[model samples]
Target: MNALLVITALLAATPITLEETRTQGRKNTQALQAELDVTVAREDQRSARSNLLPQVQLSAGPNLSYQGRRRQVVTIPVTETEVLTREVVSSANTSDSYGASLGLSQVIYNRGLWKQLEQAGVNVDAVRNQSIEEADTSELEAIRRFFTLFLSQATLDVLQATAKRSEEQLERARALFHAGRVGKTEEISAEVNLGNDRINVVQRQSQLVADQVQLAVWLARPGTEALQAVDPGILQQEPAPAPALDDALKQAREHRALLRALQQRVRVAELQRAIVRGDYLPRVGLQAQYAHGNQDLGPFFSEPGFGNTFNGGVTLTWDLFNGFNTDAQSARAQANIRRAELTFAQTARELEAEVRRAHQALDGQIASAKLATTNRAAATQGLMLAEERFRAGAGSTLEVRDAQLKLTQAELVLLQSRIDVEIARYALYRATGTLNPGDSQ
Candidate 1:
């Protein structure tokens, strides 16, 4: 009993709503990788920005030396008038020394470096936009899976209900045949219908299981079986009006992440051109250094050894020329900028067409849903009338069977139409770059 209860609880914990599905789907590998890319880009931007600040360095080390024994000559005064020469011997000795230096450098002017820093910032924005696009894609996929699972469940429910009705019809036909009110053919026909419905039910159940496994994989669930999709009753609601084409296009222009990323790339390329051109100008900086050390004037430390030095200066560097390398790079940067601009233009056109296509599709599906609703209502009434006539012995078994089949067809069509309408609406939203998990209803 406890084990069964635990299983039931786990089953209930499975996500069924669109929001929950989106929450799970956001952990998809592609989306996470995009986020990681954005983080890396941000780090690069920081590194580039840090180059504008002063750089400081410190160094310290010890030095060692040795001297070999050698002979030296000395002159001495004698009787204040004559000088005497003598030979002197110097002993071998060793000395140890240590020094430390601290230096600071700050760039006063480096146009190329500043331009490169700007490019880094733009690259970060591009990566961030890509991450948003990836997240939206994953969320849209989750929405698709949610609806697929819902449709499968709805289809199976319909099959099961039809199968139950076929069973009753079969039983009734057999009773009438035994009473001589109907023939064996009628009984056989009813049995055949029941068998077909059962087969359909089995097939639909298999499909439902497959869809469940698919959704489970997205959710990272270990078990694929025993999942259930509860209907959110979206089908019963009235269809919403289609969005205006002008509005959709405007939204696509304003909100599309991929387009924005492309625009950022164009800016990046323009910055790259400026950076390359900046190489033609001189770079200026200010630098300062302080050093302190102790060393023996003689190998035996015979003299004062402590000393310190401080220095400060301005520096300038000019490339002048480097085998036309800067010119070639500048040309390449310009070409890349052109390429980026063209890509953005092409994508903008494609996006507008996509929105228009989606708008038309949504409108069509809404019309289909409205038609299906009317057909289903008529089918329901026809089935009731056929059943009444058959119970009164004024109609044949075939008429009742036909009515039931028509009603089943109508119901299936209605279900499909409703699903299509919702899918179309979301497809439009995706095309306009407005799709999100919250819109899944």
Candidate 2:
């Protein structure tokens, strides 16, 4: 057992990929809540379906009764010729009765119940589709947090490298100052730059810690454990081309879970309207019951001592008037149907707009990433020249520092632009309702 426990602990601490984290988040977070809702909806559908089947009930009980004395006059013939009047009396102290009954009711023709069953089915579909949407949303969130942590870690790497370079520069400046080849100001500037870089390293380290904790919470893990994310190939590959706006809009309409859920809602509302209208028609049902009783508890089921009863019937019920309640309900259902239609239309338009925006943003990020790549190359070349000139004593200290700073900024920009391009692709996927755990790359 101890060995097993150790293995489990080690497994828990293992680094996970982005896809794994997404799956874990779904199991542990709001996605599970959506799954529970789907379960409840399914149960509701089951309950509605049950109304179409026969309902049976069984009952058993005992009863006790007491009766007071009663007197009655009676006529009797005596001595073969004369008639005589006589008094008779009867009384009972207590009587015990035991009874058992079973009854069954079945709906033969209930339009309302049929329509309600249909509505419940529609509701299940809507809830399931909504759950899918929730899962997609959770997956996108997990991706965002994963990449944020990755970016923070990459930034720390840059800061650490820059700090090492600054330290070397400071040492060179100090040597030059001691030999009287450079002024004190040059050494002081190098020292200040090194200190700033060190401070930035600290800040970035703190940010990385915070990001790690946030992701741990999302994955339902211990927040203090150091968690690392494996690259899921999103960063290495070039961003895919965005689809045309018209094609994206079409995909959004056809594949978006939210839109599909809304469409189901419209159908549910229509069914609801039909169900309410059904109240205007008569309902038919069948019922049967069997009952047995005995005054004494013993031999309750005996043929001579027990009483048996059986009853069966077909029933029809109609509501002639109910203070216009049905009319009000029908009107409300109609209004709901109209509201659902409007909402569906509104959601489609909003989704189309979102798709367009995400596509545009992706295009822009791709362009920016390409631009940053070119700038980083140029900055690297400029830094190399600046350092070479400084070593040859042909360039000033300020020129070298400026070139280094520019190169660092360009590197940071390129990293950011790459992350942005990947994020924008994810956004486009989400806008088109295609984001899923399997699409982590």
Candidate 3:
């Protein structure tokens, strides 16, 4: 830290080298790419679990009880017949009971090509694709922020250089005033101008720092090293040819993750309809229950203890008659299928439009970036001339200052144009779903 401070003092407004900042941004983007991959893998696992066999549960419990019974007796009448027989009968008793059991069941059949399972698989793909898209978007944002800070830092560097030149000119003006060749006002004006330039440099440096911090946060960096910025226009690639609108649209339709997810959802919707419609079909499955229990006896019934029970059978169920509800359900299923088909068609059209618009925008932006670069070159030359003319006393300080401002503005414009190109590139990547961490490297 002390070394950096010493260097800053010595350099006093000179542009610092920026090699570390770009590396940090790249690292952060790579991490996000890996994170997205994990997300996709988890979604795949979740889908597999959903497709697995249904789980069975077992339960057991005990019971207790008591009961009462009645008795009946018969006798002969006194006056009627000489001799008659009498009889007596007793009722049954009741008691407590306990039991334990196991049971099993499973899905036997369905129509529509195992639609439920297919739907689950599609959902997994959709979520994974969306994750990739989100990651790409995040990476793009990080790249932009890093570049923004870099450019801001560059601007500060230029301002610092210009401020130093003004300080030198201020010294010269003071010397000229002492020699009675220039007025005191010119000397004071130089000092005042230098102070303003210093302030400008400081403000821009603050902006650059804030931008770097934001970039670091997005990258999930672990520690703080005062991140330096990168030089702009260092072996920048030649602008690539823009694809035709139709071609771009076709590529996007085949690629964009959001579009693909929507396509998957349409399949899922169709599958859901098939699942409900399949309810009308007869289903076959095996079921088995094994139990052990004791029951109490009551009145006419006798008590039994520790009895073993076993049952196994195949079952078939058909909703043959359901107040015509199944017919309505089938119709609804058909309607949902139609709706999904329409949605798919609509999505395709929308995707085409988005791709076409992005292509058009990128073409225009690339041209704009080139023009801005040309302007910056010319302005730089103009500033050089102004500085030389002022040194020889052929031009006023105002001329030098004006040229300096022009050069800075030109630099800013070029920077903005470059940013526009990158943003357009991000747009293209979003449309095509072709953004890879590889692209950053």
Candidate 4:
């Protein structure tokens, strides 16, 4: 067990990838809450369905009673020729009784009840779709957090490299000054550059720590520990082509879980209106019951003669007038239906806009990544030439520093542009509602 615990801890400390982040996110609190909502909706549907089925009930109890007689009427024949009557007090006694009853009831026809069942079924569908939407959203958010942490790490890496290079330049300048070959100005310039570079590195490190905490929170892990992301290495490859705007919009309409859930809601609202209308109609049902009981004048639980009863009947009920309650309910249901329809329409428009925006962003990022790639190449060449010239005594300290700074900026830009391309692609996938976290596409 101790060895197992060590291994688990080691695994937990390992850097996480995009796929792992999304997998853990599926078990996050929001996703779990959405799943519970679906369970509750399913149970509601079952309850509604039960209204149409037969219901059986059984009841049993022991009954105890005591009565004191106040008065009684007695009649007797007196001497075979006359009759006498008198009023007199009676005795008190206790009686014990046991009784049991079984009953069954079934709805023959209740339009409103049937409509409610249908509405409940639609509600289940809506809740299920909403759960899917929530899960998808969680996965997308995980992807975002993963990329943000990766960007922070990449930026820090670039800054540290620049700082290291600046330190070397400073050492070179100090050596020249000690040998009386370069003036104090050159040494001072190099010192100031290194100091600034070190400061930037410190700032980047602080940002990195904050990014780690954010990623850990999204993963539902302890924020006290730091988190790292494994590079997806998308930077090594050429940017993939972005899809056409119209195609993305089409996919969004077809596959978005939110849209499907809203459509289900509209159906539910319509069914609710139907149920309200059904309240105006009469209802029919069937009922049956059987009872058995025994009473004794002696002690409790004593044997006594028993009696049985059975009853069965068909029942019909109609509301001649209800204080406009049904009318009010009908109006509310109609309003709900209209609201559902309008919400769906509004969402559709917003979704289209989202898809278009994501597509445009992907296109722009791809172009920027390509341009940054070229610029980085140029900066590298410029840095090499400047170092060669400085060693050959043909370049000033300021020129070398300028080249170094440009190269550093170029590298950072390229890194950011590449990462942005990936982020933009992910946004497009999310907008199209087709982003499966671990999928290669």
Candidate 5:
């Protein structure tokens, strides 16, 4: 963290860079984006699991019908009386019908369902790793953006220092003219030089602001026009040590999301093959049903009646041959599994290469930053000696100014080198597959 500037504190301040200002913003956004990516990935796994569970549904319906010539057996009456004997027979015709039901289904034995569920569970895990990869990627981007802004701000500081020196020189030249020691033309040339320096300073400042905005946009923060701080330590904080190339490569193979996703893809293909082969087997299930309806008997006997019916059975399903779809599907799954294995192989090689390169970069930048520190210290010492010489009238103003310029350049370079080290360390971390999520916290 850099100290916030108060007016009195600004008078005693060591200026900081735009990079330090915007890094916080980008870091915040990276956390948010990471969470979103992982959440989406996990949801896909959950969706696949739903297919394996038994399904239940509620249903209601009414039915009506009209018909003719309904018939049934009838019992006839026989009787004899004085001067009279009688025989009875029965016959009739009529029609009407109606009904409704609610149904439920549970998977008893489906070879494909269990296998698909397994695939879904693994796929969800793969997505979680993919989110980690996304987080690593986001962190890398933030580091670059933050440091690039720092670069712009360092350049701006150099220009501002030059403009301040030019203005002071112009004032001194004008004073010398008033004392009749320097000519009017010399003073006029100083004025022109100072004006040009002012323009360069303003342009560089603008560039710094633009760079800061670029980084801050990622964090979703408002832009600061010019960076301000009371201390410069934020620009110099170095990251931790890097690992060996072989170690980095080995770690990446285990932690990289792309590799995990491809592995899961191959697993899914194998599951598909298992399911296809299952079609050759049988799916057996049990079922029971109850129904009631009105049955009429009319010709030999006339009446309306009702009866209940019950049924129970074991059902077996087998696709004797599905136009060779099973064979074709299994063939496709086998090809896909092979492709996934090939893809994983290719990606692992690429990841290993990246890890090795990042390791080298990390090592190189560490050395660069050390040299930059030594150079800046020497330059600062030189600037002090030059100022002392000028105070004693033994050195020219030009020499003193040159030393100051060199020192300023050295500081700027050192700041950049430090940022380079930071960026390299982060790249190595990402490449080595050690970038952790939840950084915003």
Candidate 6:
């Protein structure tokens, strides 16, 4: 009893809502890596922008030297008499020198680099949009897995209930056969039906276990934990009417992250082409530097003997020719721009088709769900009447068996229809680029 209580408590604690599952899935490595890509893109933008800013550099170092000296005698003439004079010269000297220099450089004109900066900005936008699209895709995957598990569990439950009813019917058949009210063949048929139901139950149970394992992996949960879906009715609420195809297409154009990212790519390609064109123009910049040097570190700044110099100049560089490298690059850039434009156009058409398909599918599922609900109600009434008639000895076992089968089939169809509607609704949301965890209801 104590062990059973512990198991029950564990199971109770393990059940998670759809929202919680979505939250856990977003913490997965795939989603986190997408977010990291966004950060990397932002840093790249900053790096590109830094190239256009004034660059200042400073350098300082110390040097030590050793010297040797030699002495020489020279002859000098004074008042018609020759005199001897001593002269000294140093071949080497020991000295400590310290020097510091500061330099600044600014781009005055470099259209290529400027365009590159613009392209980097566009790249950042593109990556950011891509990240959002990745997030939506991940969340949709999680939702799909959740629904699959839910449907499996529901099927298992239905099978278990059907098995229970089959057992009861088998008991009735046995009693009737013993009393000679029913033939042996009828009893045998009930026995076979009960066996089939048991087999189905076992199979469904296995499927439920497999689905639970899959969902556990997605949620990053331990395999030992039991996973139970919340009531299907929570998700079976009627969905709102789908928008018209034209409206859906318009919404997709406005909201689709993939399209936004591709548009940014077009901008990036355009800027790249501009940058290549700039290669034909001369590059110009301003360069300035200040330097001070002396034999001693401390006296370098205070002493007048130190060499101090400041220089400033404007520089222009023209690459007259470089083995036609610029020409080839320009051609490539132009081609890329054309490719990007074509790709964007193709993707837009594909997105429109996707939205239209999702809209129609959702509509069909909703209608099917309504029809299934009505059929299940009728089947339930038929089962009740057949059971009553069998008890009154006015109907045969086969009639009851057929009614039960119809009812089971109807119930399963109804369940499936509801699940399909929910799945289709989410699909439509995904097609419109509006799917998110919060919108799952």
Which of the two, 3 or 4, has more TM-score? Answer: 4
Q: Give residue 150's error in model 4 in angstroms.
A: 0.7
| C-alpha TM-scores of all predictions | 0.85, 0.89, 0.75, 0.90, 0.73, 0.85
Task: Mark the regions of model 5 whose C-alpha exceeds 4 Å error after superposition.
Answer: 1-47, 64-98, 151-158, 166-193, 221-241, 290-310, 385-398, 437-441
Q: Give the lDDT of residue 50 in candidate 4.
A: 94
lDDT of 6 by residue, 76-172 (tens): 6655776757675647667788888999999999998999888888898898788777777776677777788788777766776777787788888
Best by lDDT: 4
**Candidate-wise lDDT, in order:** 0.82, 0.83, 0.67, 0.84, 0.65, 0.80
**Worst lDDT window (10 residues) for model 6?**
1-10
Model 1 lDDT per residue over 1-441, tens place:
322443353366454777677777776777888999999999998899888999999998888999989999989989788999999999999998877789999999999889989999999989988887888777777777778888877876687778778888888888888888878998999999988887887687668667878877766665545556666678768988997899999888877888989999999999999999998999999999988777643432343234778999999999998999999999999999999999999999998898999999999999999999999899989988987787666877789889888989998998888888887888888888787524221
Full ranking by lDDT: 4, 2, 1, 6, 3, 5
What's the lDDT for candidate 6? Answer: 0.80
The worst-scoring run of ten residues by lDDT in candidate 4 lies at 1-10
Query: lDDT at 251 for candidate 1?
Result: 84
Q: List the residue pairs that clash in candidate 6.
A: 67-92, 67-93
Candidate 6 deviant stretches above 4 angstroms:
1-13, 23-27, 64-96, 184-188, 220-225, 232-236, 301-305, 436-441
Ranking by TM-score: 4, 2, 1, 6, 3, 5
lDDT string, candidate 5, 1-441, tens digits:
011222233344234443444345335665567667667756766776666554544433334454544444543445543343344443453445433233434567878777777776776666666655665676567667767765665666666666666677667667767876656775776677667766776676557557656765655555653333323354546545667677778777766666777788778778878877888888876665555444332311232134445566668898897899889988988998898889888988888888888888988888888888889889989977975674454655566567767877787788777878877877877776665533211
RMSD in angstroms, all models? 5.4, 5.4, 6.8, 4.9, 8.1, 4.8
Could you tell me the TM-score of candidate 2? Answer: 0.89
Clashes of each: 0, 0, 3, 0, 3, 2
